[model samples]
Target: GAGVSQSPSNKVTEKGKDVELRCDPISGHTALYWYRQSLGQGLEFLIYFQGNSAPDKSGLPSDRFSAERTGGSVSTLTIQRTQQEDSAVYLCASSLSKPAYNEQFFGPGTRLTVL
Candidate 1:
């Protein structure tokens, strides 16, 4: 991927349903991150992966949310038994390296709605 790409720019689903958002980071990028942003809230980090370093899943709100990065490139975010509170834009970002932390590029994000 030339830059971060998030799928289903917009998703409208019924409450209690599940949704999966995809992200393809720029080539050669070894660090990927997921963040949740509600209409009136600031970006909340959900997860982060940097090379072989331990993934930081410190911000996942509950067991219903999870994410993973394979081969250190593409990543997916899944929300199980989604709730109305899950409605928000899921953004993905990636950096070329640890020293390039400030250069993380963000994806357009998938706007999910749990009705």
Candidate 2:
């Protein structure tokens, strides 16, 4: 796809179950970011990967949330021991390089429902 693509547009998992959300950014984009948007809330930054530098994980809500970028292209966000509070729309975005100036291309997002 020309733009970012995310797998399993919708996911419903029982509480305590583990889930993995996948995101494939646009080819050649060097910066990838993961954000979570809850009901009636703004986007919350989760993680950021830029080139080969270490990922900035300062925004992750908890230890249960983790993400990795493989080959600087595809990214996977894993949630372990999910809870109802984890329910939200997982969004993936990518930029050419510096997110400050480059326009970010966002995926449709994976709507996660924790029951």
Cα RMSD for candidates in order: 1.5, 0.8
- Model 1 regions more than 4 Å off: none
Error (Å) of candidate 1 at residue 3 is 1.4
Provide the overall lDDT of each model, using Cα atoms, as 2-decimal numbers.
0.90, 0.96
Worst 10 residues of 2 by lDDT: 65-74
lDDT of 2 by residue, 5-113 (tens): 9998999999999999999999999999999999999999999999999999999999999999988789999999999999999999999998899998999999999
Model 1: how far is 15 from its true place, Å? Answer: 0.9
TM-score for each prediction? Answer: 0.93, 0.98
Best by lDDT: 2
Candidate 1: C-alpha lDDT: 0.90
Local lDDT at 100 for model 2: 95
Cα lDDT for residue 95, model 2?
94
